[model samples]
Target: MPSKMIVSAASALCLAATLLPAHAQVPTVRIPEAVADWYNAGDKFVQESQKQKVNERKAKNVILFIGDGMGVSTVTAARILEGQMKGKPGEENRLSFETFPNLALSKTYSADQQTSDSAPTMTAMVTGYKAREGQLSVNHTTARGECNADTIARNSVKTILEYAAEAGKATGVVSTARLTHATPAATYSHTSVRDWEADANMPTTSVAGYPCRNAPGAVKDIARQLIEVSPAVRSSLKVAIGGGRTYFLPSVKNGANFFDPEYPTTRGRRADGRDLTQEWVATRGPGAAYAWNKAQFDAINPETTTHLLGLFEPSHVQFEADKAADRAGEPTLTEMTTKALQMLEKERGGYFLHVEGGRIDHAHHNGNAKRALIETVEFSNAIRKAIEMTDPEETLIIVSADHSHTFTIAGYPARGNDILGISKGVPQRDGDGQISDVDSNGLPYTTLGYQNGPGYRAGGRPMLTDAITTQLDFLQEAAIPLGSETHAGEDVAIYAKGPKAHLVRGSMEQNWIFHVMREAFGFN
Candidate 1:
């Protein structure tokens, strides 16, 4: 027989357990004091800094590095992979931006939907307004069909780059993908659709096929807008480095021999004339140099180079793993970032540089965990280098993903786990009455795979796993198609440092990133 007090307490506990949800019933584990102290320190620092006045005269430089599809789990996996490669536990290698003094979580939904694409997602970060999934700088009121209308009365939002440039700061855009791609373009260009590249046609005439207000014969391509019209490029942007030289060069010059090799024609040029690259160079002073290869990029001196247009590859540059494995002509992400920062920081009023690890998104789209993890780690290295170069007080450095991938970890084994292998200790039994085992590269005791969603799996081995588990599975159970994973609708994390970084706290909408930057730069 129990004591009266013990019996009463047991009865209350039983009632509470019965009332709670199944997931909530899991016992809460307290973190160690040391770890808790570290977290509390960060929180207190953020709160204290937020209360202080931001002296606009003190801070001048701002650098934003976006790992397009890198979710919290993606960062964890990358850190682990990097650590393992260097012969240490995954947790030993901290991400470059992980050490930021201020941290927050960002809600990444678009205006029209829960899950987000890069177009509106990046647009929200750059423009401070949520738009439709495919739209760029324009708000939800603007229709996709009217994207190219010159005089259409639509609410226009200024991008961070635009604001920074207006405030007399140098701007630069660098990525591992095309310069006209969604993430990079959002900084300066505005269009309803993210995919309308050079070849894609835009709305020219009205619904009746007649010319309407501010309507042109055809819509201007994104590439042309960036090179010809964007205030970032046409006005204050001094260093524009990344891939996608094909979009700028003439067809023959771009290695497309449709026209005469000697007389190259610019692709999709209605009235802009051929030789857009030449025109862009002319816009820069006489000393502007364009380099399409590593040798040319290496030769350009930061002191002498007034303007540089570096397009290292014909298309989206190779994945970090592919580049590292091959040791090819392409420059590393860190190298690109270093060069861009070096050149931009030389400007007197400080600079706004956008560096992106664009391939991380592509890797997740392909369901290639290895490639994604490697690219993510490489991106982290770039961030680490930036941290080493810039001072925390003068520079506000932020590293965040535009959105999250459906990537998840499931099927648990022991603490040390390998992702690319079959799981063991599943409930399903073998005919011989022996515990079965599946072997691959360092056979993981648990299958690191998704269950049913966009990419579904039926009647396969199963082990204990979920969102909160400590495994290396990349995709979620909800992902179907049995091939690639999808993007997650959950809020992503924001890591920040430097003056006024304390503003990022609690869960925030993605558009708040624009405000954070605006506030940090004293634009507000």
Candidate 2:
């Protein structure tokens, strides 16, 4: 005898408890087929948009031009010098690459040291890996006389040019230095040493008498590499012009005759017993032609000629200032680039060409700012030509330096002052104040000059003695005992334009350049 209401509540509670397990394990609700279809469609659209974005990033062609040992200060000095020459402000003397939409800072250091040389730095840019100084596109080893037994033999990496060629893109390499020089060599050759010119497999005894001590291999030579080995390189090279005729000519040749200066002489003898000029002409095919002088280079018809080889000088081309002063007969860097572009553009697919103002680095080494500035301006002109010829949308252009020089500007002076001379604002009250009585060229009275480092002098000015200015003046001062201006351990600027150039941001390692180029060309 429980109460009737209590008994009913108990029964209801038991019934609810029975359904709790089922409710707790309930399944998720299912959407209708139409709603499911809508979601799928939206996801597809998003994926397609992403795909389009990636396609737009790949550039059809790329051109990278490096000014070895050029840094921010170098650019500033070059700009000021160009402006002064043109009677304009420094801001008005913008370089061709200055038009780029993206800029980045690049760390220039070797694997072994903070400061870098051209060889390893160029290798890093081209190969996407760091290398020790003086080493080329390979690893260093302590073993001696161990042919094919180094770490380089084990690591097989692909070059940007090789990848581009595999993708059916055209490529070319050009430089004011020997075409086989470090920067250009990084594109197609690989070895443990940068100086290796002959192939290891080649018979050393046969060519021992010739002065080709650094032959990495037979095809390693600039001429043979472009014409014989690496079919992709040869086929892609529609235009090959620079100033390394000695490497291409016979060793026995008495005199260097760049581009048949006079009528061709058969005095030189190659190992194959072939005339150097004939070998060059043969490589170009029957219709293709060659030139060696300014007049001959000018006379060539880019419209009709399919291939060209223009060697203006026997050794490295003269400095721009020397060339401008009529001390040498050679085409300007701008002229060479213009001609190369004109000839290369005729191909069905666009071309990848490299142009260098190599003499700028040479002048900087000698601490000759006047020569460096002139060479830099000449380099800028070549860049301008490339910009005008190629469309921005289809091409990606980069301007950068391999490293930095120690040269810098110092001293307190008013605007519009000549850098080569002493400061004009020195106080006249005390004997300590030295007036710069010299005019524009920085020639000082008496032999006394500013000290630059140890045993070095800035042949004229006696204004500032800081690290940067001391280095700059030391280069200018003829009496300085130093061999050359030294390179600095500092970051350099990278200017970029065209498709995917927006990716260049913040400071980055020098090897990242190769990655950028790879992604831009869809190599990965």
- Highest lDDT against the true fold, candidate: 1
Q: Write candidate 1's Cα lDDT for 209-266 as tens digits.
A: 6553224543456677676665554667877787776665544334444332212352
Q: Of the candidates shown, which would achieve the greatest TM-score relative to the real structure?
A: 1
The C-alpha RMSD in Å for every predicted model, in order, reads: 10.0, 21.1
Looking at model 2, report the run of 10 residues with the lowest lDDT sum. Answer: 26-35
**In order, what lDDT does every prediction score?**
0.69, 0.64
RMSD of 1: 10.0
> What's the lDDT for candidate 1?
0.69
List the candidate 2 regions with Cα displacement exceeding 4 Å: 1-56, 89-92, 139-156, 197-223, 253-277, 324-328, 425-455, 458-475, 478-481
